[model samples]
Target: MKKKIGLYFGTFNPIHVGHLIIANHMVEFSDLEEVWFVVTPHNPFKKKSTLLDDYHRYDMVYEATKEYPKLKPSNIEFKLPQPNYTINTLVHLEEKYPNKYDFALIMGRDNLKSLHKWKNYEVILENYSIYVYPRITEVENIAVLKNHPKIVEVDAPIMEISSTFIRKQIKAGKNIKPLLPLTVWEYLDKMNFYR
Candidate 1:
């Protein structure tokens, strides 16, 4: 049997409780054997200026996930070319691993609406499965994905937390402790990150 692995791709500017929650639930509640946090050095859709260094973000993800055996981080994109795109990452991973594992792209519900805009979006849909978790807001046109055989809408906790929000709160000297993992928060505090 092919091992089922879900790719939870994100920049993870600073991995927080919300990200961990979603990833943990993705493994526990879904068919995924494990969920890997694919830390992209640069996301095409988001502005690059606001992103923290890739190594910093990767370290934080590693720090946050240290307690969860099934949850892990991947710096695969760091080895790839700049401005990493999901379709390219998937293609390379498939080629490298071949039949070793079944790779599925895990995404947030909001991404569904802009799926077409991603590079080679159709190829991604055809070749690999996609598992979407609900966001704080209702997913746009979720009913339209009902007929997609490879796309699955998973039941996950709707989290209001976001790295951007946390960053802003930190800059304002607000306490974001509640939204962050203790280890992650401690690491950020020690490093004086996001100041």
Candidate 2:
């Protein structure tokens, strides 16, 4: 049987406890054998200036996931073309890994609502499974896809914490250390980022 890997893609400006909690929950509660945190290099919609250097963000993810054997940090998108799309990443991963791994998506309830806007959403829905975690979304327009066979809603904890909030707190000279893993916190403190 192919090893099941859940891809949790994010910028991970500074990977925090909230991200770990969700990834850990997915691997523990779902069929996923491992949860790979795919660090996004450049998101088209987000401003490049606000983001930390790509390697810096990747380092934080590596530090944060060090303790968990089943959790890993992947810099796959870093080698890919700029302004990457999820469908392209998915296809690349499939081709690279071939039958060695069965890849799946780990996303939030909010992302599921916007999945329709993604490039080749139908292809993704048809080819791979998506594990959705709870989020405090205002609307429920995803009623159609909610019950789809390809999408499984995992009862993971709702993590309201965001990297943006952490950055803002750090810039304000607040102690946001507890939000991140010990190693990640130390890395951020040593680098003195966001301040």
TM-score of each: 0.95, 0.97
Tell me how far the alpha carbon of residue 170 in candidate 2 is from the true structure, in angstroms, after superposition. 0.2
Candidate 2, run of 10 with poorest lDDT? 135-144
lDDT of 2: 0.91
- Clash number for every model? 0, 0
Worst 10 residues of 1 by lDDT: 138-147
Model 2 TM-score is 0.97
lDDT of 2 by residue, 121-181 (tens): 9999999999999886645857779579999889999888899999999999999788889
In candidate 1, list every pair of residues with a backbone clash.
none
- Residue 78, candidate 1: alpha-carbon lDDT: 93
Best by lDDT: 2
